[model samples]
Target: MALFWFLHLYLSQFKWITALLQKHSEIRMRGIDLPDDLIVEVLSLLPVKSLLQLKCVNKSWNSLISDPKFVKLHLQLSTPNRNLALVQYDRPDCRVLTFPLNHLLHNPSTTIPTHQFICKDNIQFQVIGSCHGLICLLRKSYTSDHTNIHFRFWNPATRVISKELGSFQQSNYHAHDRHRYIFGYDNFTGSYKVVLMCSGKVKIFNIGDNIWTEISSFPRFDHDVSLGSDRVNNGVYLNGTVNWIAFQDDLSCSTYSWMQRDTTLEQYMIILLDLGTETYKQLQPPRGDGVNLVVPRFEPTIAVLMDCLCFSHYVKRTHFIIWKMTKFGFEQSWTQFLKISFQNLQVDNNFSDWNQYQTFMFPLCLSENGETLILASSLPGLCQVILYNLRRNRVERTKDLGRIWSFAKDYVESLASIR
Candidate 1:
């Protein structure tokens, strides 16, 4: 009787323990039931590529990740100031490709292999500018009576393309046409606006409303003065304004009018177009002796660093002076950001050939914390991307890739969807 009682008690205790463990296992498999907000906060720290892969875990996760609000939040929380190179190679064929910055920064042996994203576009175009993860691409067909210059808004990350957003029915596609466009988002209106700039004609198009309205006309230049096309200037979108280096045409008489001179007589200025008020203003370039140098090739490049307008001007071969604005629209706030010398670099055989091609270096991307600047050189032959460690005061060169000048832009991967 005693043995039977003992055996029965042992069996009951074992069964109860097993049942408790089974319940615990079920909780573990289902997860701890974290709060939705907390889950999103944690998930937002992940890269978009990983987030897309995690969507298949369950329905709840899929819905959470697919939410537009979540995507915007994720974009806000994403790691900024990272290096992602958008390479547009014009050789063999015109192609837009992307690669990790470290591929060009670190030693080949120590470099982590990053997948190169070769974007496939159905139409022939060139990237004009990128904002809020939406890249603006320009495609021109001059066969028609009016110049059919179309803009394509593409979110390379989400693979969403907004085709035929707008077009400029230009009178004629002049090789020396100064027509350009800037795509920017207006915080006040909560809409994306494209600023169309020509020699004298200026217009603004609101993407959300799908309407184009003529704004104030650009400051006119004398007929004798030469007006430059978009290729001759650098266009930057910042603070709901489009900023570009506008040049005053040189009208001085020369013996050889058509001759290509090593030195130019043009003066560069910053042209600002406010998206909110539809106004135009010009900011003085950073006051310096180097800023006065005539640019034989396009040299006055504009960029945005942490809500401040930054300008880069080259004095001579590979020597550039960087200026930053501490206060927006304040000329007094302009300060020398950094002085970089690429002339001392250990150039390879291609470097000479690059110089002959009138190659120039421009800022491609800046690292998080703004410590490093990755620059690409436009060269006809293989040229390495140059990485400058601003903090360490060090200059490093990568292996020879295609001419650093291959069509490339600073690209950021995001989940921004464009319908």
Candidate 2:
């Protein structure tokens, strides 16, 4: 009862009188003194919003919550609860949103408003990637195309925004818009890093040192295999590693020289970067024929589902497929976990034929508990999001995002702040 009242009053509203009322004989708040360890443990388990509120509770609370040790420990204790996110990267309303998973699972019909972290009206920003709780934003420069792209790290929890102003800059980057950047956590060093890479150049920015170092080493290029250059790809950060969807040139059997004639299969692979080693490795994903993996909707989005790296593919705007990597670094372990058919989208949405027009859909994410997937499909000027229940194997709550949502991506909140 005391704890409940303490929290209710603590969160509902706290006044200076509330502090003065704690004038007990021992200078305690009605004998409600909590040890430093206890406070750390409790605060670590709380949500980021409540934790942010408690930072202003007192000097001691502020000091404890802001400590780097507490931030790391809190993130460790608060796994999976890292919350889901949505992003709108359109011209006028560039925004990123987030909401708790429990709210969607328990009270989905209640229409909970998402937390809008950033919304710049006229400026354009790309959500390069998100890890722990920090998001990497690449702001397109309007001044000069020759200047390096400006990247910023923003932690909504800490409300600390910092830009990477190092000397590292890309030359003639407009030619390689496919170049990507990822922000990931280094567990061994207890630090954060920004990995910016194109076809040949790779740079790493250490958050602690606030400096960017060029990485000369790279995954061996398959020069023999003919692959297309223009393709859309996204990065997925998992377990101190960042995985990017890439192609390996061809599906020819490397061991048998005669098998090289089978150039029909465009072999797709995962370009993985281990943050600890700051090195790169190429891993082949599950093999599939017939569909060009580099096509618009088929370019698999690397994602982490149920604590495993997954290849999320939207099959030409009709089917959603999830290929799970059962064991790390093993290509044969890639197994097709789920396949949901959206063939009836035309009938359901009252269209004559779904495949007639320039179709589009992006797999937003798998739900926190790995129950359903949040899918967003572009329609004319508006957008729609639907939750596909994996267990039931059906779609529910066909949500119309009301015409403004241009893009969506999965994100989990964390205490990761930029120094």
Candidate 3:
């Protein structure tokens, strides 16, 4: 009878332990349920790689990560706050400098230093554009043979890179080939497109389709003279159309005049290529005196300010002028909206005396709020990036990268992981 009692006690204890373990397991599985938005916020704060892997956590998470809305939200949250880094890449040596946007907005009283990175050769740095939480980079062969312009789409946040589209050599496309320009798209149906200008032809590559096509002909420029190397600046993406600044010059003149007098001597026109229609139309700037104003290119042409098409012109030894499109008809009037003066810049050095000839060929990016302009200037041993805040009327030097092409590996790795 005693043995039977002991056996019963042992069995009861075993059963209790088993039951406790089962209950604990159940609690762990459902541990502390969180609100959906809070969970998304927390997940967004995590590195993209971690977030991607967490997609397997459950069906809900998998769906969230794949949703376009979530992708945009996560990108906005991941965007660095009040800071823009100016990176210089020069193959083996690289440098990065960070500047505060707040200073550019309120104080304008700081000079940020640059940072460095080591990278390989043969990596060409091309800034496609920045959208949402990502910037697109196009990597091409560093050589000047005009032969192999292989393109890759990269997302810096995820460090993911897309497969190379194709070789320029194989496609009969050359970067220097006149009359040809190249453009890229993340999605053909998407809004973003990169326009590449070559010698005689302009090639438009839709990011959506990842295919290259030629712009058979451009609106005839009266003069036989060639287009400027700064064509990238002239192309603006707006309302599902890519607008290019076209100059009709006096082909008869020995020396083609650009900003010489700005009179109507050379007709300056704007051409809009609707991505949807795949057709081109011409528009004129309002009351534009083609003089002293450097034929602006690569400046932000499309903005929400005043609900019109805007173009920014940075004149030599003068303030930055903003021209707004009043009417979309054949007689479009470009009214001067804002003029940012040198005194308003509040720089230690006079901006007018600063060599305006030393301009870098990168696009000016606006902040999320659409109130600031990001400018990058590169000199022999020093490279500087500044933010000019329109609303606050201040300018701050945010980054001072010493060398160009210095952030190659970081850029490459950042792009590679995104894929």
Candidate 4:
């Protein structure tokens, strides 16, 4: 009876072990059924934060997420379609708002009012520019003793803020004032730089290293004749260099009594600051009536169209001309793309002051497949943003964001992946 009982117990134990083995094999087979490509596709769509968190799920997943090829593929898949929203801030107590890019693109007749958002009171930010789903912010602060300025690299979609770069400090020189012009990121350095122009001195601040380096090589023109006050017409980052148009005085016209030189013809020069060498060089504009062209109003009037830089010029009281850079280099060709007269649009009133709204308006940065120009107009009580399709030659009114200080576009693709 004891032998029989031992046999029974041994058989039962063997069967139980076999069942457990079978279950483990089934689970392994199920995991193998999932294709590698499918896993990659699904994982690529998840935000970077989620991907980073999932690294601990398994060894395969960790390796995949860290793969350089996967990162590139994820970024390509997540590129945001270029569409911009112009939010308004009217009431002192109003909140920040966000609008959809599709609504602005498809519905020409649809006009949605600006909605409010949280955290407007605590953060004072202005959109300097956008690139690769990242928006550069100029954060300003006011206290009792001294003023503080910082450049914040932010991702609007993910709400990720990089470490703030405090006031740039360097030996032998100080920033002219706190009201310095902070340009967006230079692609070469993958960092933001500021141009400090005050008291006849110009300096640059590299936000990545928090270093204030002096730009002593820039040609100095008399402060009186230079376009110092014309913030919009001053310095613009194009192709790699900061381009500034200034008027140089002919010193020969000095009367000796006041030491004032006679005004010469207005010259627009392209100042290229090589990121590698940290130096500035002047490039002359293409020969022709280039110097004869009047400076466009100092507003956010310049935009990147295709591979060229474009801007609108008030040709006459009733006409506007669009100019485009045709070739690269300082002496490259600049051709007129469009000569638009008010009569061409059949508009009765003259748009003489159209540039006034340019400062408050933000461009809807569109991808190659998106619309050409997106702009917002801020009126006294009511504000409207308009999107212009260059390919279709159509203009449509977008949502009516109430009074807003500044606005930007947060691309959906920008949130995908942890980077």
Candidate 5:
């Protein structure tokens, strides 16, 4: 991979030479044309900015670059160039600030530069999920009677956004009847989809079709083990499915009586919905030998690290451990990725409340080299980003990021179109 990227950079340096060659009479007279495969190979390595500019060079080149196959190829090669899309909602208009991952990784002390996208009409928006280059968002507009909610898709690289697609009324207005939205791609159908989990029911919206269809509801744990709160955010999307970390309480009368004498025995598992099949499946967390895994006072969060589903949780209220799934849907595939102590992160464990001391730490993004991780450590009203060095097992840098709703997402620039 290093050698391939070195060659890509080497070829990119000669872009001016290619333009100069086109001006030469000898090359013009020969009318030499590169083969389609060769053209795609070179173009796919260039950044999205350069490809967008080159599209105007000629009609054939424009068509080749716009082809769906080429788009997929470019996206595959663009993974290493991922960006950090940080969404700040405190402003009247929500702003998505895009920062190059390389810049943040290389210049830890410098003031990083960013590209900003301001929301229109000063409407408030909350990020649902980011996949490919498209960001799914929930827009809330105030009306005289109530708030109107809509779903919108935005591609910051192409600067093309879809109009508000659909509005859903709450199936139940109870206090605990909260809804969560997740965005992902359907590899089988070659479409982008949005999954909505509302009041225990599931619904899907296909971007190309601009239609929402009801799907199977989340599986209910055997009646006694009631499902717990679903305050999940930015679910991990991989292999045509979106996964969330959910818990079930052992609410049986006998279990409740036992809990009074014993301890809380809430079982946490991964709840994933396959986009192709529109069905739900559950996978238990890793139970390594000699390790008793249980849901922390707060909960563990899941993310995609190194293209694998990872689980991050607090251990003994002292260490933060992350586990990665080597194979999707395989319980035994879970491997410990890293373990960092609170002392290493400089976390204060002096809070009066035990739950406050067990702060929620979320893994936001991981560096391409896999040596550093961007984490969001959240307290009641405070949230901050920590850049941790995996090799040294220490914190590299800390930034407040002002105020953010949640952790930043690992974003990529692509030409994936949305309808």
Candidate 6:
């Protein structure tokens, strides 16, 4: 099935090339020659790997492939070829792995080859997230100030990386600070931006700008109260907004008190930060029938599934429920999408010591036809990538991608340059 789609798209591009060639004979009599615009239209349909080799054909083609407009065009056309981006750590070394989704879906039993980007730096960095083929890496400064953070944007497909952008300092840092950051694209400004949320204060850093602008602080909340993958406060980037599932609290409730696990007065809400407006908004999360919306011990995660915001949380540590927001910014559009039992997911069923070894399942990506969903079942130090069939409601296959440092994201290859 994957091969058919690739052949279909490949043949479709050749059809355009054939038609253009046929028209060249007729247009030869006219004064106008075959324009480069038509050539660019066909070239954009090819894969990035092919485009890189084609650059050696002529200087004109090399210049055309490097243009910003061509980069955007290629990105728009390469949406169908999504890959899984995984960051695995082996002791002190880190590796960024990219596996083509089509290959994995087609050959479930085979060990799919992955493209790896080895980080040789002495300092370890974490993948904040990916946007427009750019992976944002975060590293803490080695200096004495514990509040300082540095960022670097790298295009794994293009193999181009920008210089260390910042050693920006947070207003105040604590040992318990989650210090989460999200990378997003601002459609209004046609640029990329990174937003950092820590200590109830919010800051925005534009990609090209060498400065950080402090925005409205997040509603007073505990740093440990945010629900996300691997217990990290990761924001779901979708449609120019970064969304997180957080518990809202009053100033009277201190962060230290949160360690006591007292949640009778706390409330969970979805916080949205608009990259364009640089402001914050709160929305209520999904509420299901006979479902308790509060879970103080377990963490609920927010992810983008089929371009819709999805909320997933474990019920009594026995069942996992996923809710999808069909319409953005509309609380009424929330719908319960999936409810799978722990037995079905093959998760450990040790109920006596469940809290200590609880597993969190996150929906990483959905198939093109939407019949299958890839999930990351994260344990204490291990992560398993599972292929689940939604139509059949069963786990089709599960592969251990080794001990991953963070959850995987959908990666698309592009000619995006961070410089």
Clashes of 3: 48
- Give the best candidate by lDDT: 6
- Provide the overall lDDT of each model, using Cα atoms, as 2-decimal numbers: 0.61, 0.59, 0.47, 0.49, 0.68, 0.69
**Lowest lDDT 10-residue stretch of candidate 5:** 222-231
Q: TM per model? A: 0.75, 0.75, 0.62, 0.65, 0.85, 0.84
Q: Global lDDT for candidate 3?
A: 0.47
Candidate 6 lDDT over 300-333, as tens digits, reads 6788888999887766667878899999978788
| lDDT of candidate 5 at residue 61, scale 0 to 100 | 77
Query: Residue 325 of model 3: what lDDT?
Result: 75
Task: Give the per-residue lDDT digits (tens) of candidate 5, residues 1-419.
Answer: 44345445565675532452343334347886545665677678777777888787778879998999999999987545687666676556676666777776776565534335445447776677789888777876765545667888887788778887877544223434446678899988989888876544677888778889986444543222122312234366988999875544233233244333322223566787889888778787776454565544545678888789998777666788888999998877989888888899877645555435333567877887888988876555446667898788777554555555253677788988776
Q: How many Å off is the CA of 396 in candidate 4? A: 2.3
Residues 1-419 of candidate 2 have per-residue lDDT tens digits of: 44434644653353423432343223463666756665566567666766777677688888888888887788778544555555555556666666565565565454537445554635656666677777676665544545446677777656777765443455565653346666688878878787766554667888788888877767534322112211124466788887775546353234234222222224667777888988777787665543545333223456677668877665444566677899876777888887667653332333343232222444556666678776555555335655677677666554466532333444556666775
Write one digit per residue (lDDT tens) for candidate 1, span 1-419. 34234433543454422442344356558885545665576567566666776677678889988988888888898664233434444444445545555555555323323344445444356767777777777776665556677777777665678868777667754645556667787867868888776555677888877778886455563211222223324477887888776555343333134224443423556777778877778777777654455554434677776567888766555567678999888877888888876554333323333234343556666666578776666544435566778888777766555553334566567776656
* lDDT of residue 22 for candidate 4: 47
Task: Name every residue pair that clashes in candidate 5.
Answer: none
What is the clash tally of candidate 5? 0
Give the TM-score (vs. native) of candidate 1. Answer: 0.75
Model 4, 1-419: lDDT tens digits are 34234433543454422332344356567884445775576566555655666676668888998786886677777433443422334434323344556665667566555442422534355555444555555555556544456765555555566667655333223333324353544657656566665544667777667788876765564322222223223445556555553334233122232222222223434455655456766555433264564433322144455656554444333554555677755345677665555454333333344433334333334436644555444433335655556666665664444544234433343542212
Please tell me which model should have the higher lDDT, number 4 or number 6.
Answer: 6
lDDT of 4 at 330: 38
Where does candidate 1 have its weakest 10-residue lDDT segment? 221-230
Q: Alpha carbon lDDT of residue 209, candidate 3?
A: 60
TM-score of candidate 2 against the unseen true structure: 0.75
Candidate 1 clash pair list = 81-368, 88-407, 377-405, 378-405
Summarize candidate 3's per-residue lDDT along 1-419 as a digit string, tens digits. 34234433543454422442343356458885445765566555544655666677668878987777777566556534433333456555333333445554554445443331222234554544433333444455544434455555545445455666634552344343333232322334644455654433455666556676767865444221223333234354555665555454333222235323333312555666766556778676544464534433212233323335666555543555667777643444767767776467543223232233224323245565777765544433335555677777776664454643222111111111223
